[model samples]
Target: MDNHFVPKLTRRALLISTPFVLAGCTTASRETVVTKPIVPAEYLAMYDAVDGEPYPVDAADLTRVDPAFLRREVAYNTPEPTGTIVVDTQARYLYLVGENGMALRYGIGVGKAGLEFSGEALVQYKRQWPRWTPTQDMIAREPERYGPLASGMEPGPLNPLGPRALYLFKNGVDTLYRIHGTTEDWTIGKAVSSGCIRLLNQDIIDLYRRVPPKTRVIVLQGPASGYGV
Candidate 1:
């Protein structure tokens, strides 16, 4: 080969090998470096879930707030406080009266017009993370919507009933209506549920801890006029 051709060929070979050399250097540097932050053992333990597994909640989603929101307090009151709890289906408000002009005001989600009801009732019983059994009507109307979970939907963070449920009863009969928590927080101030009253998980959990069994529950349209006689 000619001298000039030899030099050009050598230069071409070196250029082709440059990328491989740089990649090797980077790999070696990464192996020798200790750049990642170390988490303390105590802090790592705190991050574990209740079941001793890694908690799945996204850290960015956590928020700090006043603890008072977790408690049951009478905020809005009425002069008549002697009847069952009255939920205004149209207005999406729940009223729990107290003595001396005090009531607990809770935001709620009500059923649509054709699905709502106005009547006297009581909270017959309650459940935590209640199992969802779709009614026959619901299955018939939208089999595709519920076919997968036909037997029943298990309780979890994704449950439609977020954390608690209060089953309503009228004259020793279950009305099949519920005042329960919802996974959809955006629906709290709307009429979007089938026929159940939906509350925020935090709110219902707070309410569940406060109310006792067999507490009177009444669902009404618009606003309640007179107290129960």
Candidate 2:
């Protein structure tokens, strides 16, 4: 299945998976803990209310969310061309490669299902406020929750797909994987979705506007290599 083939990251894997920083010296009594980065004031505008959509998108409340999970631009070294999307599953970060050795990175929430789909794929198409239908497997796992919407769930703020969806395909066939948005902003850096890669609603809308159909997307496999950014 050429469309389903999973490609591995050869040289870029280490650089993409490495953490930006891991501070704190170890001591017997005090355990080393990674500190959260401070969120910049400009984020207020970045996550501000989005208008003119099918539905109202309120400004995201980031006070309780992790600063690391907030969207930011950072230095990125990748052989892949600019405009390529590199998703580091292990680090829960998705990098949208940009010019001049930098990328716009977003924190993602990956679920067990997301772990199953890895490798290179293309953004076959994108939809704004796309409808969502639970897979047969998903229905079987939780009939009560998904059975009512077996046909499909309409797009809305409450919809699992949030406000946008980027469908992944291999060899011109649908992979049934998606990079979508979620209303649950707290899940940005966690592994708790049913299977899709989820970003905050605001982030997804931003991403949807940046890339178009046929964009290249690479989902990295395996654990992170403890290298510093």
Candidate 3:
């Protein structure tokens, strides 16, 4: 059956197949089947807390999140070494390779248009409850929107960067992109970010604690290019 035609996935369905099918993905390491871990209480609490000053607690709506976007396990047929991170942007999913042909998959929000990242990088560092600093380009495009943030916004639930950030680096240089948490849980499974990949604040907090610095990250453009470990 066509991936597009695939029906809505249950938690169980995700373990069996992927809606965004991987065709001709490059396999480099060992085989592993991916699966989901249990959602923790602390991860869920951040969404309920009123972190941002004016943003209502209600704005951190978890109801809008697609069930499939939640973290879960799935059958990942990849060659990338166990513990590598493979991001299928086109599919809006991130995978952490595991042993014995398995992986832990999470639904994700990708960057808009030309902002999608493709290639090998490393998680050089991580920050908890990070501040938000809008880039100069963001300020130039909409000074009214980002000019005040030139000095950086304090970390909070309202901050677009959410609860944690995993900085991505390439060849010893910053990629200016990150895998971070967002208050906008609804954005998962969509392409609506400046240039960073966003996850539910709860989810990022979960992944942040799991992924270590220097972890290999492989971002595939689309299925046509195949995936790596």
Candidate 4:
């Protein structure tokens, strides 16, 4: 098992948990559920299918996903003020800092694109059912895959950006990185994506509703609690 800085979780957080096996960044692995996880009823309901949207969202099959990646409220120790967003790329977790040392944590999937941008940034804006356009670098790297769609892809269930997207910016300029939703729920804890951070469609929707424009977001490059840029 790789070494990771486990956060000082609250008793409430610990009581509602199990042995969460962290997956590797290079390859995908099935979580070894030694003891049945005592998942809260509310957590399960949060991922349930939605009734009205631009498209239908299927309920997340928690059985196939690692419990560590599931959304939970944890005791996060960060200097960043409440309402700040922190992304621990190495741990594949994103935290929305809340008052009283608490945070709303979500599992994330990173890739080369996701790792490209790090450090402090702000949520310039957000979009629901946002259109997606492949970057020039992406077109150059995988022409056949992204070339034809250079113009842009309309928002829908098939769109890679999923249903909601939070655009990140630095110095008031677009960083081309985004915190968005993904159709590949199985990839929640993996490092396989064409672009930036991805959360489950259900999870993204929840995050979108919580944060507004200009929200501060800190993307930590290494271990979960590594303060370094």
Error of 3 at 1 (Å): 43
Per-residue alpha-carbon lDDT of candidate 3 for residues 199-218, written as tens digits (9 for 90 to 100): 87666765776677888899
**What would the TM-scores of all predictions be?**
0.65, 0.79, 0.73, 0.80
Error of 1 at 167 (Å): 0.6
lDDT score, residue 20, model 4? 43
Q: Residue by residue across 1-229, what tens digits does model 4's lDDT show?
A: 1112223335454234444434333325675545444445665676888879968888877766788888877777888877788998878899987667777789998876434578899888889999999999899988999999999999998999989999999999998899999878889988887659999999899888778788889988776443322
What local distance difference test score does each model get? 0.59, 0.78, 0.73, 0.79
Model 3 lDDT-worst window of ten: 1-10
Q: How well is each residue in 131-199 modelled by candidate 1, as lDDT tens digits?
A: 887777678878999777779887777777666898888889878788897656567678898789987
Which number leads on lDDT? 4
Identify the runs in model 4 with alpha carbons over 4 angstroms from their true place.
1-41, 113-115, 224-229
Per-candidate clashes come to 2, 1, 20, 0
Query: Model 2: residues >4 Å from true position, as ranges?
Result: 1-40, 113-115, 223-228
Model 1: residues with Cα > 4 Å off, grouped in runs: 1-83, 227-229
> Which is the leading candidate under TM-score?
4
lDDT of 2 by residue, 85-116 (tens): 88887788898887677777888988774345
* Candidate 1 Cα deviation (angstroms), residue 65: 15
- Rate residue 228 of model 4 by lDDT: 22
